[model samples]
Target chain A: MGIKINVERTSAPKEKPEISQLGFGKFFTDHMFIMDYDSGEGWHHPRIVPYQQILMDPAAKVFHYGQTVFEGMKAYKTPDGRILMFRPYKNLQRLNRSNTRLSIPSLDEGLVMEALKQLIKVDEDWIPSELGTSLYIRPFVIATQATLGVSPSEKYHFMIILSPVGSYYEEGINPVSIYVESEYVRAVTGGVGNAKTGGNYAAGLKAQQEATEKGYSQVLWLDGVHRKYIEEVGSMNVFFKIGNKVVTPALNGSILEGVTRDSVIRVLRHWNIEVEEKTISIDELVAAYRSGTLEEAFGTGTAAVISPIGELNWQGDKLSLNGGRTGPLASKVYDFLTGVQRGTVEDPFGWIEKV
Target chain B: MGIKINVERTSAPKEKPEISQLGFGKFFTDHMFIMDYDSGEGWHHPRIVPYQQILMDPAAKVFHYGQTVFEGMKAYKTPDGRILMFRPYKNLQRLNRSNTRLSIPSLDEGLVMEALKQLIKVDEDWIPSELGTSLYIRPFVIATQATLGVSPSEKYHFMIILSPVGSYYEEGINPVSIYVESEYVRAVTGGVGNAKTGGNYAAGLKAQQEATEKGYSQVLWLDGVHRKYIEEVGSMNVFFKIGNKVVTPALNGSILEGVTRDSVIRVLRHWNIEVEEKTISIDELVAAYRSGTLEEAFGTGTAAVISPIGELNWQGDKLSLNGGRTGPLASKVYDFLTGVQRGTVEDPFGWIEKV
Candidate 1:
């Protein structure tokens, strides 16, 4: 169904800085989109209001029960100067999936798409034209009912905010060392692990700090059972390249079904490379490393795009992969994914949505 | 180190209703205790502000990274017209434990105690005098940093909000049916499951819902490693009484060290009841039930001080406990604990703190 759209503008920022110096999630555009849902009156008061702090009761359910869900995508300024979004439909689908898991109400996908387009058009100037830079769009839903009961909230709020961001990695695509936390399980079967909710990231902060203190960049969480099988990192999906065959952990109910992960698999298939999504345990990986068959490892996500995993430290044992740098497969995957996202490569699957 | 607490009071509710009509966390006291902490400033800005909505950034670190901690305790109006808290120091100690685990800064316990005293003195009328009624105090700490990076926040806000809560079991104290979630794990060895953070509750919501959908009141989570050992139920520490011996799951790295759990052990030892805080698996409990040795099963926490477990459904197998209602041991334990909380019993351990 088509969604009714409205726009309310805000006074422009006093000074819009040059796009090169902009940071991630630091600056907001002129407007934000919001809608409310109640048990009696379903989904009322949709508006594009001025960007500002949200006034919330100190006892909001989102703060207590963590009843929240979010989506992250970018509005890229193409060479032709037109604003666009990569796989907007995928983001919409994943947002609904997250809502279902979190017990929050889901909006119509078509309405979300239309509202996103309206918001992007109203704040089109926020889109940066610099290479590898774009306006990040964050659409999140929270339980806004003023009650402290543990069950699901009867009322909710859906809001979208925009921020201009430069490249994630300041350096030119440097490889990262990741810490393997075998004792901590990020997700478990029958848990809300496959959803894009805020709690998943919140649960990973301690491990992330441990990795940072150990001079690693990110954490690699293992399966809840056994704690040996490879699971996705909290922020990104992981992939391993052993010789010519590519393998990733199967979506074992606890791993998120990432949009970029799907795209990567599709691209690999298009290139006629063998892509396997199955359970790959660390023991197998270690044996492969010893035999010199594990050629490369990389992480995939919206923010990081593709991150090369050079070395992994688990239980005081460090294993270096592909000479501690980005390997051939990782480099090619990076260039190809970035090219597709930036509209520099031919769109074979019509994943780009023009705004 | 003394704190100069300046209590600014607000008008109470227009008409104080009877304690029976009170709901869970709906109505609150007039004033709230708040303090701020910063990297350089340390803990400052201690004030009693009118209970109002807080203007928070949409990208606050607590909303994104779950850098939040909370403690749950109650204020009881004794028969002799005294407002008291059941071992407030225990809550302070547990709050510090949770804060340290989540990387959130800790507060001075004495300062926290003084703040509570000032707050209760200002709103003492909110404490209910009826049996099993209480003024639930929720002391929560949240990261107020505006940035979105996945790390500990530099600034924090600590606030205590009070609500009049009626009895948890409106149908009178009775046993509840629980679903044994053998497939899902609440926490891992190195995980933040033991901490009272939003993430652990968020991760447990789906399983709780699943259990509720299957006609159970709560989900009994298992250890992350083997999913065989019992962890906790909903938000309480569990105990199994077999052959006149009280056995609870040991305080493993992943299990929360609950205040009630400690108190129960202390009381049992005082009453000459054998108690052990050792690992108790589901298989052993089921076997005891089969052999007719399991006398009683109960859960203890701030809310629902002692909840009897009537039945257990584990992986399509059902086991019934003694007397589908409150057992003798559970009743005695519940009454004795509430007696100490309400100041009807002598506090040999000096657990009660009068506000």
Candidate 2:
């Protein structure tokens, strides 16, 4: 963990974009963190260099075999110039978990954590100060071995790039219409779905495209083995509030163990709210809706934190929740969570890390 | 379809490796094919240039979202100094099919096929003349857009690289040991399993490594739902010769329709052999083995043509097929298929195309 990191700043620093107009993952900062991994040499040559193009062989394993893993986190800039990251250690741990599943070499979490903090401090000015805006941190690893063989690559690149994102909902908290995807399966029990790899996201793209074309914001995925039990919504963890109890899908092998999902459940339990992780089927949800007890539905992730589900279009039936508006519990969770992330509220659970 | 392809000769040609030492997808040729695709402009700028490293952005969609597809084929140099490729059109078609599933833009198959022929002719000297040896052609498409969004990329690079190879079996086609996996799931019916994409291969690496460590060459995957029906074996279509009936897994949504697989079935039928495509289960296969009617088993793909299965280890039980030797049917299929590819036998089905 005491590895020396070489720092090479860019000679010509480009002007920063208008923070208000910077959408998600569009504008990058001036510098990035780069590290290399060889089979025998292990992960070495950790450095911070100017953000630039990566020269790779056309036959690199990631290009042809999808041997890559990534993690998404956000950094917030408070009014007092404090930089805050939510449960960064958890994200890095998940990165290693993903690496194990994809057969990629693991990175020393402590070393990577130190490098990430240094990179953030180098370009802390790139962090947006808007109410909901933050610096999006994308840490990814790609197989770089240039051989067209179906095996784990012996070489890889671990990189961290930053982008300034605008407020998730600039206007206000809005619940989106979600279509329950019935056709395309994202992941199964014995698949790479739970791992934070590119393949799981690739499997969901077609379904998202179809749902968007049908005037839905995202598609709620059902379990692969049974096309009834709820799995996830879009790329985020989903939760439903039925009657007086709130429930979310259990962390089955095929479901991503989202950090936000865990934080949400913790916060709910801290407030003495019943948050059960259970296998809730679509039929049960529809029945609850018919009985007028389906109160609210929402998705949790780093991007939105809390994306309320206002309308659900499943098969040929349509169900509206909370009269197609943001539910009270969703609004409370959003405000409290964002407030904690941005350092405007108390952090009783030690989820915030200062850089 | 009628696009003009610009050819650029390399100033420095690489020294060709020893034909006998060429193992699989190593030692690429001098020239390679390149093309570009954009959302609005479609596919353009087809050219044949020196085989070199491709410079891509670190944040390219392919690196983060696994938005890529690829195809594999082989070219052989016959004794008459003629170059012949097997079922190229089919590979290109499957490439487009993969692109559609991954939400990438479609490529013009005719244009790609023309460029491929021109490129192969330019590098025809690299083809090896050894028995069972051929030039491995890898055509792949990568998403080049430097955005970290979850959607498909707007820009892409479609390139074809050729690698000189030794025979799949430098010694002889000795049947391999296989482990019938019950833990990992490769693909499901409503997923991208049918597509020739990197994600599918990436999902199989863990199981393959485990099998190899346990003294097995490959692992046989079962259905995601039932986990009993045989789906595929080591990224190839599988067949079982039970009694007088030879059967392969039907082309269900989760199974890839391999070009070699189709060719094998056709040649077997042409010889008046009864080849049935059915949903065969592992239990059924084990039952047949118990009754001593599991005459032969093998896998078909671009690399091996026909890889006989000598032993299958499933759930701590071993089922040795054909007394741990290559069966007559598997040997016959290999002889006829490789013979046709090498132009030593009659091409009655017209599978070969001269370069």
Candidate 3:
């Protein structure tokens, strides 16, 4: 079924922020994509309306039950003035997966993609042209049912908002220090950890705050059950280069299947580099570091394509990787991923979609 | 500091629903209590406003990161027309505990109690007079900062809304069948299971839905690690009567410290009944059932006060407790608790507060 989205432009648009000063998710475009879902009607009334405050009943399930899901993607403005989105379909697919896990209604991926492209076309000027800046796209769905029950909501609202963001690393691709959290667990095998829902992120806030207070940029969470295996770092998937093999935590039931993680694995295989998805415990990592086999470590996500780990503080024992600098593998992965995203490198994997 | 609340009464009052037809959380009162919290300003602008829709930016962290906490309580209209609240201070303390765990700023409990009392007084007419009917109070705090990051929100909105609710069991106190979920875990130790936050509820939606589909009223969640030890049943704390002793899972790191659970323990001890809070595994429970010692089982929460577990389905085995009827102990506890809440019984423990 074709979805006809009604467009309503803003009459009075606000002043655009300076591209150099555009922080993450602080500013939104003039218009946004919205659709409503009822119990029987499914998803309906797809539209592009002027961005404004949303009115909801105070008893909406999102407020009390957190029945919501979200996706993060970006639309980049190429040097030649073409707009490109890196693996947008993967984001949509993961969004539906999240919806399934949260018991929210599924959306037509094809229709949502069409609506997204139209929305980007309408607000194409929002895309930043700076070296690393791009228009961040946030697609989210929230339960709007006005009830006070701990169950899946019968009503929902799906919305897509755009924000012009500056470079993640203001200075450069600097390696960040990480604190390995032993107390707090982000997700468990049978929990909603694999889904892109708010609960998983909310559960990590305390650990993240503690890590920051300890002079760490992020917290590396261990497995929930044993509290031994490395799960993920902050909101990103983590990778370790021990000896010569690039190893990441296998797609366990708890670890999120990040789009950037998948792309990096594909690119590494394309280059014929040995990449393995396996469970690497903290003990193994510590032993590898002591033996001088842990060469480099990095996190992969949309915000920062590849964030190298410089220092790791595991229960007061600190290990500095690659002399506390960005390693060659991390740098290469970052450069290649950003190059492909910005249209500077050849599209060998057909990962970029023109908008 | 004294909070001078601004009162804005509704001009056109809504028609109150029929007392006999008032379902759970179906009808709202005329007014609600609201307060705002800023990063530096602390909590301010306390007010009693007309119950209505709330306006918020789409980028609010509560919608994206699930930074929210809530409390459920009720105002009982006694036979003599006095409004009674059972252990309101305990609910407020638990709310603050939830805030601490979620990284949200703490609220001044004394000031909040003042607001709640004032609001309850203003909407006293909405309290239904029928048996087992009362005015349900929902107090919640949601992160309202218009930013899209997975961290604690700097701005929050604390609101209390009242709903005239009918009895959870409209016919009378009835036993419910429970499904022992072995696949999806509610929460794990070292997670947010102990907190009264939205994320914990959102994580259990899938399992709850599955249990409902399997002809059960609620899902009995086991420990996330072993999936052997009993944790909670649906949103309530579970209790089991084996032989002559009442046993419940101890206050592990993951189980919520339920106010009703604590009260029940107190009342049980007051009656000189043998009660122990310890780890009770499913195997032990099954063995007790086979040995004819599992005499009764019940769930305790604010909503139902006491819900007797008539049948439990663990994998393929089914255990019918008390001949699938409301056990004598559950009946007596429910009557005594409701009697105290409604001012029909003497308050020896001083759990009731008057509005």
Query: In model 1, what is chain B's TM-score?
Result: 0.97
lDDT of 1 by residue, B206-268 (tens): 778789899998888888767789989878899989997999999887778888999999999
The CA lDDT of each predicted structure is 0.82, 0.91, 0.92
A228 in model 3: Cα distance from truth in Å?
0.4
For model 2, how big is the iRMS in angstroms?
Answer: 0.9
TM-score of each: 0.95, 0.99, 0.99
Best by DockQ: 2
Question: Each candidate's fnat, in order?
Answer: 0.53, 0.80, 0.75
Model 2 C-alpha lDDT per residue in residues A152-189, reported as the tens digit of each score: 99999999999998745433368899999999999999
- Score candidate 2 by DockQ: 0.84
Give the alpha carbon lDDT tens digit for every residue of A80-121 in model 1. Answer: 887778998989998998888877777888888888889888
The TM-scores of chain A alone, one per candidate, are: 0.96, 0.98, 0.98
Which residue pairs come into collision in candidate 2? none
CA shift of B134, model 1, Å: 1.2
Shift in Å, residue B164, candidate 3: 0.7
- Higher-DockQ candidate of 2 and 3: 2
